[model samples]
Target: MTSAPPRVLTVAGSDSGGGAGIQADLKAMLANGVHGMSVLTAITAQNSLGVQGAWELPAEQVEAQFRSVVDDIGVDAVKTGMLASADMVRVVAALLRTLPPEVPVVVDPVAVSKHGDALLGAEAMEAVRSEVVPLATVLTPNLTELGPVAGVELRTVQDRELAAKILLDAGASWVLVKGGHDGGDTAVDVLHGPGTRQEFSAPRADNRHTHGTGCTLASTIASYLARGYDVPSAVGAAKQYISGAIANGFALGGGIGPVDHAWQFRGSGQ
Candidate 1:
């Protein structure tokens, strides 16, 4: 009998479009050679164009799913996304606090969708800053999310660095400030942790169908962490993976589509 691979669980919402949220996380984990599990927090009526509607699951239900996975399956690492309410965020954070210190948690502060649909509101964002950020081993926030989460406006690279530092001081062991929305010739992401700062740059892919980029990157990092990679190494590898995924993004609906989570498996005849 073969041994089971590393286990990575995602606590997030369901994207009916199968592009972002829990769908993307599971796909990225599988592509990265981990056993993927999920605890669905909400359900979104979403597509390439935008999110039509979203309904958060009850806190009790969310907690039940999480305990079901962790108490038995036992996650090696965890990734969180699209926590729709302050109550839900608190519930997830409380559950995370129960995990052993060695278990890495990747928190993706998902505030808005690719097409400008709000997934989390002001109260929920505040809860994430106070409750979720402190428990995260890695806090992954894109450019638009940085200013709000850190309570500052980001205008330059130094501002981004400052925002990352604010998040680090808030208690996340590492903060990955993604520059995908920065609209430059190159996509640069800054990873800042204690006594360490690294810049990862990739040529900006000219693909309009680049949805799910953030969730995929964070999930890939958690997957690598589950596989025993250090924080910097895992984030670096995830950056490479997401870059390829972005380059291979293909059109689906009228608006933006999704990154190719299985881009590595392309042409493999699987």
Candidate 2:
């Protein structure tokens, strides 16, 4: 008989393109040997190129979905993305408070997509910064996402580190500042927190089909966290996973395609 797998729950949106949102989160979780579960908060009409349209689910439905899962199977770790509205963020935050503090929580404060499409609304910003982020064990934000939270411009590597610090100060126990979008020969991602700050640099992959990198990385970290890895180790492993995924990214539907989530399965399409 097969043994049970680690359970990682993702509360996010769906991307029709399968590059980002819940699709990417589940792929990352399953790719890392975890049982993937979901509570979808929204759905996007998206493709490789861009998000054409998005609609958020009612807050009641979001809460019901969360209750359905957490009240039963339970989650080893919980990851959130694209709450979409202030009311939804508040609802999720309240639900998180009801969970035992030992359950790891990863909050991917997703603000915009790689293609510059707005995912979260302006009203949700205050809710996220005040209510949701404080409840997170870790917060993942790209450089572009840092500008709004850090309350400063992040045009350089130093700025990226500072942004991570600012996010940590606000509430997150840990902050991962993704630098994949930063233009350079080498890509740098930073993780900052209480005791120390570490930086990782990998040679930039010249791959345009690198959609979903951020979501994949955050969920990968949450997957690792669910499996009992420490914060630093989980972040390091997730960084390696995302970098490799970017290198092996494959083309899909029209527009920028998604990174190969099952990179380890290779071209076999497992």
Candidate 3:
């Protein structure tokens, strides 16, 4: 028999809308050719419009789910999103510390949903900045997330680099600063790590169906890492993948829709 596909595990909240959080992460992982697993941190009552309700899982439950996956199936890489509280962040961080150092961890510092729904609380933000963030192998933070995590409002290219530097100093081995909110003709994302810096740019797709772009991008990166790609290559490929996904995005509900995860295998070959 052939060997199993690389496995990528996501620890995050579940989006009932199936557009973001754990749902999007798993979809992205599968699209990127990895076996996806999840430890649901919270259950969300959400739709295209926004998140209506959210209930965090008990820390014990989160631990159990994580242990069940890592202790048995094991993980080649990990990604995190929408941790509901500071306690949850700490718990996940501690667990991540126990993983093999070779396993890359992509941390999507998800603070708010595309519809402006607050997914992470203020108190939890501190925990992310102090605990969860420092453990990231590759920290993927969009414009809005970069500001809160790095303690600076990023507007210009210089500002974005400054924010990335702050995150790098904070302990992530690398930082990918997403510039989707820059309102430009080109969508740009910068990847920065020790003695290395690169920018990946794609023509901005004028699509409003971009609800889960952040989660999808981060998950794609983690999946690539699980497949044995290095950080720069993983981030570059994920950028291209997400660019195509955004272009292929289609409207679903009355509100924002999600990025198309399967654009590559849909015959167009992306």
Candidate 4:
């Protein structure tokens, strides 16, 4: 028989909107050819418009869920997003530390949602920096997440590089500072790591249905990492995948829609 697909896990919140959070993560993982699993940290009553309500699971529940999956199934790679509280962050970080170092971890510091809802609390900021971020094999931070995460002002690409250094100092092996918020014809992201710095640029997709881009990108990277790609290679391929998803994003709710996770299969009419 053919080998089984790589197993990837996402430890994050649940998005009822089905656009971002755990929903988007699983979809992206499947699109990238990985077996996806999840451990929900919070539940959000959300839609394309905004997050109407949210409730975080207790630390004990979060810990239990993580142990259940990781102890039994075992994952090749993992991605984290939308940890609602400081306690949750601490628990997840502690568990990650115990995992085999070979398993790559992609941490998406999801502080805010696409509709401007606060997914992570202010109190959790320090936990993210001190607890969560340090365990990341690849840390993916968007423009909004960069300043708060690194505690520095970011404007130009140079500024992001500086902020990346701060995160690097915090112990993340690699950092990808996403520049999709910047004004330009092309979207640029800088990956900063040991002895090398690289930039990945793609044409900006002019679609409003680009919700969940960050989640999709991070999850896709984790999926690739599960399939045995190195940090740079995983990030590069994931960027290409998300670019297509963004370009193919179609309208759904009254506000922004979601990036099509199945964009790769759509053009062929499959």
lDDT for predicted candidate 2 compared with the true structure: 0.86
**What lDDT does each candidate get?**
0.93, 0.86, 0.91, 0.91
Candidate 2: deviation at residue 157, Å? 4.2
The CA-based lDDT of model 1 is what?
A: 0.93
lDDT, candidate 3, 1-270, per-residue tens: 998999999998999999988999999988889999999999999989999999999999999999999999999999999897889999999999999988899999999889998777778887898897788999998888888888887667788789888889989899998889888799989889999899999999988999899999999999999998999999989998999999988788899988899888785533
Q: For candidate 2, lDDT tens digit of each residue in 111-162? A: 8987898877777877888898788788888877777756678777677777
Per-residue lDDT tens digits for candidate 1, residues 1-270, read 999999999999999999999999999999999999999999989999999989989988988998898999898999999998999999999999999999999999999899988888889988999999999999999988998888788888789888898899999999999989988799999889999989999999888888999999999999999999999999999999999999999889888989999889895212
Q: List candidate 3 segments past 4 Å from native.
A: none
- Model 2's C-alpha root-mean-square deviation from the true structure amounts to 1.9
lDDT of 3: 0.91
CA shift of 225, model 4, Å: 0.7
TM-score of each: 0.97, 0.95, 0.96, 0.97
Residue pairs in steric clash, candidate 2? 48-255, 48-256, 49-255
Per residue, candidate 4 scores C-alpha lDDT tens digits across 1-270 of: 887799999999998989999999999999999999999998989888989999999888988998999999999999999888888888888988889999999999999888887887777977899898789999999999998888777767677778899999999999998988888889998898997799999999788898999999999999999998999999999999999999999888899899999999999221
Candidate 1: worst-modelled 10 consecutive residues by lDDT: 261-270
Rate residue 252 of model 1 by lDDT.
Answer: 94
Question: Which scores greater on TM-score, model 2 or model 3?
Answer: 3
